[model samples]
Target: MKTIKGNFIFDKEENKEKIDEFKKFIEKNKDRKGPLMPILQEGQNVFGYLPEEILKLISSKLNIPLAEIYGVATFYSQFTFIPKGKTDIHICLGTACYVKGGADILEEFEKRLNIKKGETTEDRKFSISETRCLGDCGKAPVVEINGKQLAHFTKEDVKKVLEKYK
Candidate 1:
Protein backbone atom coordinates (compact mmCIF):
# COMPACT_ATOMS: atom_id res chain seq x y z
CA MET A 1 0.00 0.00 0.00
CA LYS A 2 1.23 3.47 -0.92
CA THR A 3 -0.12 6.83 0.15
CA ILE A 4 0.12 9.41 -2.59
CA LYS A 5 -0.76 12.97 -1.73
CA GLY A 6 -2.75 11.84 1.35
CA ASN A 7 -4.57 9.05 -0.46
CA PHE A 8 -3.77 5.41 0.21
CA ILE A 9 -3.41 3.54 -3.07
CA PHE A 10 -2.83 -0.19 -3.40
CA ASP A 11 -0.13 -0.80 -5.95
CA LYS A 12 0.07 -3.84 -8.24
CA GLU A 13 2.31 -5.76 -5.85
CA GLU A 14 -0.08 -5.22 -2.96
CA ASN A 15 -3.00 -6.44 -5.06
CA LYS A 16 -1.03 -9.53 -5.99
CA GLU A 17 -0.22 -10.20 -2.33
CA LYS A 18 -3.86 -9.83 -1.33
CA ILE A 19 -5.03 -12.15 -4.08
CA ASP A 20 -2.37 -14.66 -3.16
CA GLU A 21 -3.62 -14.69 0.41
CA PHE A 22 -7.16 -15.18 -0.83
CA LYS A 23 -6.00 -18.08 -2.98
CA LYS A 24 -4.34 -19.73 0.00
CA PHE A 25 -7.62 -19.45 1.88
CA ILE A 26 -9.44 -21.00 -1.07
CA GLU A 27 -6.97 -23.83 -1.20
CA LYS A 28 -7.54 -24.52 2.48
CA ASN A 29 -11.33 -24.75 2.13
CA LYS A 30 -12.00 -25.70 -1.48
CA ASP A 31 -12.59 -29.39 -0.76
CA ARG A 32 -14.72 -29.10 2.33
CA LYS A 33 -18.44 -29.83 2.29
CA GLY A 34 -20.40 -26.56 2.03
CA PRO A 35 -17.25 -24.47 1.65
CA LEU A 36 -18.64 -21.29 0.17
CA MET A 37 -19.89 -19.78 3.38
CA PRO A 38 -16.73 -20.60 5.31
CA ILE A 39 -14.60 -19.37 2.46
CA LEU A 40 -16.52 -16.13 2.39
CA GLN A 41 -16.33 -15.72 6.15
CA GLU A 42 -12.58 -16.31 6.14
CA GLY A 43 -12.21 -14.00 3.20
CA GLN A 44 -14.07 -11.31 5.10
CA ASN A 45 -11.87 -11.98 8.09
CA VAL A 46 -8.77 -11.57 5.94
CA PHE A 47 -9.93 -8.64 3.82
CA GLY A 48 -12.27 -6.82 6.22
CA TYR A 49 -14.97 -6.76 3.49
CA LEU A 50 -15.67 -8.68 0.31
CA PRO A 51 -15.35 -6.49 -2.76
CA GLU A 52 -16.47 -7.64 -6.20
CA GLU A 53 -12.88 -8.23 -7.26
CA ILE A 54 -12.24 -10.67 -4.44
CA LEU A 55 -15.67 -12.26 -4.84
CA LYS A 56 -15.04 -12.79 -8.54
CA LEU A 57 -11.74 -14.39 -7.73
CA ILE A 58 -13.40 -16.68 -5.23
CA SER A 59 -16.15 -17.58 -7.73
CA SER A 60 -13.67 -18.42 -10.43
CA LYS A 61 -11.42 -20.41 -8.12
CA LEU A 62 -14.31 -22.41 -6.66
CA ASN A 63 -16.10 -22.87 -9.95
CA ILE A 64 -19.24 -21.27 -8.51
CA PRO A 65 -21.37 -18.60 -10.15
CA LEU A 66 -20.64 -15.04 -9.11
CA ALA A 67 -24.36 -14.34 -8.81
CA GLU A 68 -24.77 -17.17 -6.35
CA ILE A 69 -21.86 -15.92 -4.27
CA TYR A 70 -23.31 -12.43 -4.24
CA GLY A 71 -26.67 -13.79 -3.19
CA VAL A 72 -25.07 -15.45 -0.18
CA ALA A 73 -23.09 -12.31 0.69
CA THR A 74 -26.19 -10.12 0.52
CA PHE A 75 -28.24 -12.54 2.59
CA TYR A 76 -25.90 -12.18 5.59
CA SER A 77 -25.87 -8.98 7.59
CA GLN A 78 -22.45 -9.80 9.02
CA PHE A 79 -20.92 -9.52 5.58
CA THR A 80 -20.19 -5.97 4.45
CA PHE A 81 -19.06 -5.09 0.94
CA ILE A 82 -17.78 -1.66 1.96
CA PRO A 83 -14.63 -1.22 3.98
CA LYS A 84 -15.02 0.16 7.51
CA GLY A 85 -13.45 3.43 8.48
CA LYS A 86 -10.88 3.86 11.21
CA THR A 87 -13.50 5.18 13.59
CA ASP A 88 -16.81 3.32 13.85
CA ILE A 89 -19.77 5.44 14.93
CA HIS A 90 -22.73 3.30 15.96
CA ILE A 91 -25.81 5.34 16.78
CA CYS A 92 -28.44 3.36 18.60
CA LEU A 93 -31.92 3.51 17.08
CA GLY A 94 -33.64 1.30 19.62
CA THR A 95 -36.99 2.23 21.11
CA ALA A 96 -35.43 3.71 24.21
CA CYS A 97 -32.79 5.66 22.34
CA TYR A 98 -35.18 6.84 19.64
CA VAL A 99 -37.74 7.93 22.21
CA LYS A 100 -35.05 10.05 23.80
CA GLY A 101 -34.34 11.73 20.43
CA GLY A 102 -31.86 9.33 18.91
CA ALA A 103 -33.06 10.24 15.44
CA ASP A 104 -32.05 13.83 15.96
CA ILE A 105 -28.68 12.74 17.19
CA LEU A 106 -28.25 10.49 14.18
CA GLU A 107 -29.12 13.39 11.92
CA GLU A 108 -26.58 15.54 13.68
CA PHE A 109 -23.90 12.95 13.06
CA GLU A 110 -24.87 12.64 9.42
CA LYS A 111 -24.75 16.37 9.03
CA ARG A 112 -21.37 16.66 10.70
CA LEU A 113 -19.80 13.65 9.03
CA ASN A 114 -21.14 14.51 5.56
CA ILE A 115 -21.97 10.85 5.03
CA LYS A 116 -25.13 8.82 5.55
CA LYS A 117 -25.38 5.70 7.64
CA GLY A 118 -23.28 2.77 6.34
CA GLU A 119 -20.87 5.12 4.61
CA THR A 120 -17.26 5.96 5.32
CA THR A 121 -15.94 9.44 4.89
CA GLU A 122 -13.52 10.13 2.03
CA ASP A 123 -10.65 10.46 4.48
CA ARG A 124 -11.58 7.05 5.93
CA LYS A 125 -11.46 8.46 9.43
CA PHE A 126 -15.09 7.77 10.21
CA SER A 127 -17.86 5.36 9.30
CA ILE A 128 -21.44 5.99 10.46
CA SER A 129 -24.01 3.30 11.15
CA GLU A 130 -27.18 2.75 13.17
CA THR A 131 -27.77 -0.09 15.55
CA ARG A 132 -30.92 -1.54 17.08
CA CYS A 133 -29.47 -1.10 20.53
CA LEU A 134 -26.21 -0.63 22.35
CA GLY A 135 -27.71 -2.23 25.48
CA ASP A 136 -27.33 1.10 27.31
CA CYS A 137 -30.93 2.28 27.48
CA GLY A 138 -30.25 3.99 30.77
CA LYS A 139 -28.19 6.36 28.67
CA ALA A 140 -30.62 6.83 25.87
CA PRO A 141 -29.44 8.47 22.63
CA VAL A 142 -26.12 6.76 23.07
CA VAL A 143 -23.41 7.06 20.49
CA GLU A 144 -20.64 4.48 20.55
CA ILE A 145 -17.40 5.37 18.81
CA ASN A 146 -14.67 2.82 18.39
CA GLY A 147 -16.35 0.55 21.02
CA LYS A 148 -16.55 3.29 23.66
CA GLN A 149 -20.01 4.67 24.46
CA LEU A 150 -20.84 8.31 25.03
CA ALA A 151 -24.13 8.32 26.87
CA HIS A 152 -26.96 10.80 27.16
CA PHE A 153 -25.74 13.04 24.35
CA THR A 154 -28.18 15.50 22.83
CA LYS A 155 -28.10 16.93 19.33
CA GLU A 156 -26.96 20.26 20.68
CA ASP A 157 -23.93 18.60 22.28
CA VAL A 158 -22.84 16.61 19.24
CA LYS A 159 -20.09 19.00 18.24
CA LYS A 160 -18.54 18.79 21.67
CA VAL A 161 -18.66 15.01 21.52
CA LEU A 162 -17.06 14.91 18.07
CA GLU A 163 -14.30 17.27 19.20
CA LYS A 164 -12.81 14.66 21.53
CA TYR A 165 -12.50 12.26 18.59
CA LYS A 166 -10.84 14.65 16.18
Candidate 2:
Protein backbone atom coordinates (compact mmCIF):
# COMPACT_ATOMS: atom_id res chain seq x y z
CA MET A 1 0.00 0.00 0.00
CA LYS A 2 1.16 3.53 -0.72
CA THR A 3 1.89 5.60 2.34
CA ILE A 4 -0.14 8.63 3.39
CA LYS A 5 2.14 11.61 3.81
CA GLY A 6 1.23 14.09 6.56
CA ASN A 7 2.54 15.38 9.85
CA PHE A 8 -0.23 15.99 12.39
CA ILE A 9 0.85 15.65 15.99
CA PHE A 10 -1.95 14.81 18.38
CA ASP A 11 -2.53 15.91 21.95
CA LYS A 12 -3.93 12.95 23.90
CA GLU A 13 -6.35 15.15 25.82
CA GLU A 14 -7.80 16.71 22.71
CA ASN A 15 -8.03 13.31 21.05
CA LYS A 16 -9.91 12.02 24.07
CA GLU A 17 -12.37 14.91 23.84
CA LYS A 18 -12.90 14.30 20.13
CA ILE A 19 -13.35 10.60 20.83
CA ASP A 20 -16.02 11.31 23.43
CA GLU A 21 -17.79 13.69 21.08
CA PHE A 22 -17.75 11.13 18.29
CA LYS A 23 -19.16 8.49 20.66
CA LYS A 24 -22.04 10.79 21.55
CA PHE A 25 -22.65 11.51 17.88
CA ILE A 26 -22.81 7.82 17.07
CA GLU A 27 -25.11 7.07 19.99
CA LYS A 28 -27.58 9.66 18.74
CA ASN A 29 -27.86 7.64 15.51
CA LYS A 30 -27.66 4.21 17.12
CA ASP A 31 -30.67 2.94 15.19
CA ARG A 32 -29.22 3.89 11.83
CA LYS A 33 -25.95 3.03 10.09
CA GLY A 34 -26.47 6.11 7.90
CA PRO A 35 -25.04 8.15 10.74
CA LEU A 36 -21.54 6.84 10.09
CA MET A 37 -20.97 9.45 7.41
CA PRO A 38 -22.20 12.24 9.65
CA ILE A 39 -20.12 10.90 12.50
CA LEU A 40 -16.99 11.07 10.31
CA GLN A 41 -18.09 14.43 8.96
CA GLU A 42 -18.19 15.88 12.46
CA GLY A 43 -14.80 14.38 13.11
CA GLN A 44 -13.36 16.12 10.05
CA ASN A 45 -15.02 19.39 11.04
CA VAL A 46 -13.17 19.21 14.34
CA PHE A 47 -9.78 17.95 13.19
CA GLY A 48 -9.56 19.53 9.70
CA TYR A 49 -8.98 16.20 7.92
CA LEU A 50 -8.85 12.59 9.08
CA PRO A 51 -5.46 12.52 10.69
CA GLU A 52 -4.00 9.24 11.97
CA GLU A 53 -4.77 10.28 15.51
CA ILE A 54 -8.41 10.95 14.61
CA LEU A 55 -8.78 7.71 12.65
CA LYS A 56 -7.34 5.81 15.59
CA LEU A 57 -9.77 7.53 17.91
CA ILE A 58 -12.71 6.63 15.69
CA SER A 59 -11.53 3.05 15.38
CA SER A 60 -11.21 2.68 19.13
CA LYS A 61 -14.63 4.21 19.76
CA LEU A 62 -16.42 2.28 17.00
CA ASN A 63 -14.51 -1.00 17.45
CA ILE A 64 -13.34 -0.75 13.83
CA PRO A 65 -9.74 -0.84 12.64
CA LEU A 66 -7.59 2.12 11.73
CA ALA A 67 -7.11 0.75 8.22
CA GLU A 68 -10.83 0.80 7.47
CA ILE A 69 -11.26 4.38 8.66
CA TYR A 70 -8.29 5.55 6.67
CA GLY A 71 -9.53 3.65 3.60
CA VAL A 72 -12.97 5.21 3.81
CA ALA A 73 -11.56 8.69 4.21
CA THR A 74 -9.25 8.25 1.22
CA PHE A 75 -12.03 6.80 -0.93
CA TYR A 76 -13.92 10.08 -0.62
CA SER A 77 -12.46 13.27 -2.05
CA GLN A 78 -14.23 15.57 0.38
CA PHE A 79 -12.38 14.10 3.34
CA THR A 80 -9.31 16.27 3.73
CA PHE A 81 -6.52 15.23 6.08
CA ILE A 82 -5.08 18.73 6.26
CA PRO A 83 -6.52 22.01 7.48
CA LYS A 84 -8.26 24.19 4.92
CA GLY A 85 -8.02 27.97 4.96
CA LYS A 86 -10.82 30.39 5.74
CA THR A 87 -10.97 31.64 2.16
CA ASP A 88 -10.47 29.50 -0.91
CA ILE A 89 -9.38 31.14 -4.17
CA HIS A 90 -10.19 29.07 -7.25
CA ILE A 91 -8.77 30.11 -10.62
CA CYS A 92 -10.40 28.50 -13.62
CA LEU A 93 -8.04 26.75 -16.02
CA GLY A 94 -10.55 25.62 -18.56
CA THR A 95 -9.56 25.51 -22.22
CA ALA A 96 -11.08 28.89 -23.03
CA CYS A 97 -9.95 30.50 -19.82
CA TYR A 98 -6.48 29.00 -19.98
CA VAL A 99 -5.95 30.22 -23.53
CA LYS A 100 -7.13 33.64 -22.44
CA GLY A 101 -4.49 34.10 -19.72
CA GLY A 102 -5.91 32.04 -16.83
CA ALA A 103 -2.44 30.78 -15.93
CA ASP A 104 -1.14 34.32 -15.59
CA ILE A 105 -4.11 35.22 -13.43
CA LEU A 106 -3.32 32.29 -11.12
CA GLU A 107 0.31 33.36 -10.96
CA GLU A 108 -0.78 36.86 -10.02
CA PHE A 109 -2.89 35.51 -7.18
CA GLU A 110 0.01 33.35 -5.97
CA LYS A 111 2.40 36.28 -6.06
CA ARG A 112 -0.05 38.62 -4.40
CA LEU A 113 -1.21 36.17 -1.76
CA ASN A 114 2.22 34.60 -1.36
CA ILE A 115 0.78 31.07 -1.48
CA LYS A 116 1.10 28.29 -4.03
CA LYS A 117 -1.78 26.16 -5.21
CA GLY A 118 -3.35 23.89 -2.54
CA GLU A 119 -1.58 25.84 0.21
CA THR A 120 -3.00 28.30 2.70
CA THR A 121 -1.37 31.64 3.39
CA GLU A 122 0.71 32.09 6.54
CA ASP A 123 -2.09 34.05 8.18
CA ARG A 124 -4.50 31.13 7.48
CA LYS A 125 -6.86 33.49 5.67
CA PHE A 126 -6.35 32.44 2.05
CA SER A 127 -5.98 29.17 0.15
CA ILE A 128 -5.40 29.06 -3.61
CA SER A 129 -5.95 26.46 -6.32
CA GLU A 130 -5.95 26.12 -10.10
CA THR A 131 -9.20 24.40 -10.88
CA ARG A 132 -10.28 22.66 -14.08
CA CYS A 133 -13.21 25.00 -14.61
CA LEU A 134 -15.63 27.32 -12.90
CA GLY A 135 -17.99 27.30 -15.98
CA ASP A 136 -17.73 31.08 -16.45
CA CYS A 137 -16.13 30.68 -19.85
CA GLY A 138 -18.15 33.60 -21.25
CA LYS A 139 -16.05 35.71 -18.96
CA ALA A 140 -12.88 33.83 -19.75
CA PRO A 141 -10.08 34.02 -17.24
CA VAL A 142 -12.29 33.97 -14.16
CA VAL A 143 -11.36 33.59 -10.51
CA GLU A 144 -13.32 33.16 -7.31
CA ILE A 145 -12.30 34.59 -3.98
CA ASN A 146 -13.87 32.75 -1.07
CA GLY A 147 -16.50 31.58 -3.60
CA LYS A 148 -17.32 35.17 -4.60
CA GLN A 149 -17.08 35.15 -8.38
CA LEU A 150 -14.93 37.64 -10.26
CA ALA A 151 -14.83 37.48 -14.04
CA HIS A 152 -13.01 39.06 -16.99
CA PHE A 153 -9.96 39.97 -14.99
CA THR A 154 -6.60 41.47 -15.75
CA LYS A 155 -3.55 41.87 -13.48
CA GLU A 156 -4.88 45.22 -12.28
CA ASP A 157 -8.29 43.73 -11.56
CA VAL A 158 -6.60 41.00 -9.54
CA LYS A 159 -4.77 43.65 -7.49
CA LYS A 160 -7.99 45.53 -6.82
CA VAL A 161 -9.78 42.33 -5.81
CA LEU A 162 -6.99 41.21 -3.49
CA GLU A 163 -6.93 44.56 -1.76
CA LYS A 164 -10.40 43.85 -0.39
CA TYR A 165 -9.31 40.45 0.89
CA LYS A 166 -6.22 41.78 2.61
The residue-by-residue lDDT of candidate 1 on 45-145, one tens digit each, is 87777766778889998999999999999998888777778888889999999999999998998999898998877777878899999998998989898
Error of 1 at 91 (Å): 0.6
Score each candidate by Cα lDDT. 0.83, 0.74
* Candidate No. with top TM-score: 1
Error of 2 at 14 (Å): 8.4
| Candidate 1, pairs of clashing residues | none
Model 1 global lDDT (CA atoms, 0 to 1): 0.83
Any runs in candidate 1 off by more than 4 Å, and if so which?
1-12
Q: Give the TM-score (vs. native) of candidate 2.
A: 0.70
Q: What residue pairs clash in candidate 2, if any at all?
A: 49-80
1-166: candidate 2 lDDT, tens digit per residue: 2233343244556567766776687667645765557768888887666666666666776777778777878887778666566777788899988999989988998898877887776666777788888888998888887777788877778788767767
Task: Please state the error at residue 149 of candidate 2 in Å.
Answer: 0.9
